[model samples]
Target: MTGTTPTAWQQRIDTLLHALADARRDAAAAQAREVALLAEAVEIAQAMAQDAGGPTSVADIPMRSLAAQIGAAARVSDRTVQKHMSDAVVLVERFPATFATWAAGDISRGHVRVVVDAGVGIDDNAARAVFEDAALEVARRETPGRLKPAARLLATRLHLVPLQERHTAAATKREVWVRDLDDGMAELIAILPAAIAHGIRDRLDQYARRVIDARDTTDTRPTDARRISEVRADVFADLLLTGHASPDVSNDAIPADEAIIARVQVTVPALTAVGADDTPAELIGKGPIDTATALRLAGTATGWDRVLTHPVTGTVLAIDRYRPSDHLKRTLRVRDEHCRFPGCRIPTYRSDIDHTTAREHDGPTELTNLAHLCRRHHTLKHHSAWRVRQTPDGILHWTSPTGRHYPEHPARTLVFTTEQAGADIQTGAVSESATASDPPPS
Candidate 1:
């Protein structure tokens, strides 16, 4: 029998497989290049250490100058350069086998990183070598995620100190930290004992369920429900701020009618608010939230404002278009979402609505004349060589000091429609359509 020609689908599959293999090979080669760079950094650090008349140990090396040199050369942060230098030293001197594997394209940088992290605290050279030897095999066979836990387990068993003593030492390091994020958001991180952390998470989950139950049974609004994740977050905040689990009810010691209302600005579609549509709502500082959460928030709102937008484009169609007033400010706040400067994510609530053209230069007090800018960027606009212009569609164009130009459009929530949903199912293509509109700023 004659050999069969490959089908079109089979040829496509072959092409895809070849492409995937090429990508993997390229990634491995990149990892090898990184290892080389790290080796160079280690040498440079060692030389700096010697020049400083420090001890022969890599740990004693003056990292500040070394990091500065590496950072300038690599165009990376000094902290990043320092981390790379440290990782390189470990790979070159301590985890030789793992490094060899990574250099040879047999394993990735992630695998090497796992081996290094796992071998921490193993001071004895022989023990470290043993740990690396065991980890290398797992790295070759398993994903980084699986290899990490296995390597960690091996290190724990090989550690010379008792586990209880390690636990006691670690307990002293337990702490909490807060990090400010863009869009007026923040992250609260807690480092606690595993059992205690899990207990906190579990309790939050339970309270979230209760909140969900209360909303489903008692709240009649369409947008009042929240995702489990949102509910858990709310519960966590409540516990931290007021020692309460639910925002709708006070603690057992406080009266039920005295429940403190949580105040947040959410812009929901009129159709969604009245149960005609389920479009997602935009939380002023937090971006888009599910319709249920929006409804729940709206239900507790003490005041309401009606903003209209174009049906198809979702652009704000109606605003106090007459002058620079509070109404125009509110419209700009809802429209811009965040600072209009390129790459600046300061939320509108914390930003200033500034005129693109100077008022002294005869700039009109019109919707198209305004843009939201964070305080920092606002000052930069007036004092530096940065220039800004706004288009009729409310898109802002920025020209930097170096003449680099950037275009920024208002942030809009995504609305999933029935037609789009069906198209996604049939063609495996999901489309994102803007769900909100902004009026031009005065």
Candidate 2:
């Protein structure tokens, strides 16, 4: 082979990269344009409703046939099209600035998604304008996963209703439902409060870890090997079905290790912690929780952390998780909010802190060499042809088997603006403003 083969491959890669960029921009623009078309469809439905002397309200748009017609032309699901039409009305009307950004290709459809999800809580047009300006500015630079925290915080700030009040109202809507999956399996879905839900998951995870770790040491012969996920599922089922993790066929009850408890992080502002403010306390990887719930958890918590973060950048300036577990781990958890694999959003609490360089290669157990990786990605890194390196700044530069490079960054990549914190709207102001507005949830 000629020495020019490497040069040829480089040129091909450059071509692919450029094409991918163009395609992404085109796709975003297409999505932006879809909003307008969907808006027009809704308008047509409204006109039909008005002409027939029928209910002309948005919810009563009677878009079943309209959506079906559109769906036929677009070869999409009528139900999905109806849902999109509802969401489109919101984007095109309520968040024109954000829509424009997507149209201009400054961000992707995923960015719009997070913004829309967060925007629904605003319920006021002017407040949403402020939110859009702050969020869109940050959304332009960061990935959708990184944008979520900023978006959520902006949504919380812009709401006129007190978080506790809204949370209480929202809580009323919580219930569990089941959906059928393939192969005679069903997915048990629980729509619970953030704190409770996350706590349940954490507890299951801790139990799963204990079971997996003790597999080799325990004298009892295990039924079958299982991954952490499988163990967690099995434990959940066992607890729900028989009131314990493992049922004793010999009338023996296994001792519960109360010390192996779940630890959930509740990140509240110093003011909020002391009841000086009512701002929502975050459930870390989960979204905001009510102040009452936060206090309850904090009151009973065994450990405490004094985390100092940059107000504007949201950077972790310093943190002390207080637990004897490696301080490096606590710091890494705060820094790497999720797995340091491109596009992966698995929370760091459920992930492994991996050495970017193998420890066998004399990699130090320090910040630069350490980052969180979900078991899937960690296994892929070790078993597949993928390779990764971490920069001192906590960027994970991963090279695929095909030699494609994807750069993963720390979760704090979200940029915060003064508007995100409700500085623009003054007290008792948000509700009074933005009286007239638009849109529907996706």
Candidate 3:
């Protein structure tokens, strides 16, 4: 009976392991099939390009036509199609052995990507072939994470250029990027040289240690103090802006009496701004932030632009700006919050407030007639088949040349009027509909 029970448990464990292995195989098979399809698409694109003029120049390739066809068929964006096409060309033409290995489920798509990324800019086909051979072998034996650094090192060695030269060349590509994350936060990434990057990190760490030491000795703070990471981040920002270790630091070098005005736009509900409500505020470029942080920031604000918005509809009612143009711009900024173009999220402040119906055609300059469009979208609107119309409610309805329709609603603020608050208190239920008919809050 004991032997039978042990055998049964072993069988179940084996079954689960087999299932996971099958899933991995299935995923690999799918990737292989996708690569095959991409290869075919690339062939068709090349054939079309040749038929267009039999031209010798890269510019002669009808990329737009190819991208459009692939995008439509695959239900992907043009940029995505372009990437797929590039990958297809590289896999089928440049790394056939690696492609075969990937198709056979011996290596993952990630492994393939690492190899391809490493092989880029290698003009000599023989050198690329050698690099691919070594990289593929490394990929087959190692995880993608382990293979990437190995592949990169192989590429550098194969390049035949000095390491310092490569480092200098790569340093030119250093950049800073901001990626919006979930939960109203953002990731600010800085790609810099190793020396500079390490220096910055070490400096932040030093400041963080100082903060920890200061809190321990001078303040009766709880054991659950701000984390080392949090302190370091705050210190980094403080040093960058005010040249101080902390915001409260007052010394001969840096005076705490001087105000540090943060130049950031935050759209808060009128009631929340006045402490009547606890509704969250929308930090421009970021998403919704908590009301406490919003209130704290608002309290320290050096200047203010009072924007009155309808409590129910969340529509901009009026802007109290000193300049007429500034008022118009603020009204549009509050109304749009982002570019009105479909799927575009460029902040309204960075976007151009365009007249949907042209001024030459006698379009009014009212909020209803104006639309916020990024520079690229504005040019596309004028030149391409993208048409935009703003409804009375400020919702933008877009019509593509293919007759596809997309609607972009106005950015809504979360604010409850006195009547809506009263309704919630009486019924013990809260909903947007309860406030839909309510007058704007004072």
lDDT of each: 0.63, 0.73, 0.63
Q: What is the C-alpha RMSD of each candidate to the true structure, in Å?
A: 22.4, 8.1, 27.7
Compute the lDDT for candidate 2: 0.73
- Clashes by residue pair, model 2: none
Which residue pairs show backbone clashes in model 3? none
Per lDDT, the best of the predicted structures is 2
lDDT tens readout by residue for model 2, 408-440: 767664534355463543432211100000100
Candidates 2 and 3 compared by lDDT, better number: 2
TM-score of 1: 0.48
lDDT tens digits, residue span 139-165, model 3: 765556545544664465456454445
lDDT value, candidate 3, whole model: 0.63
Q: Estimate each model's TM-score.
A: 0.48, 0.75, 0.46
Local distance difference test, candidate 1: 0.63
The local lDDT score (0 to 100) that residue 108 gets in candidate 2 is 92
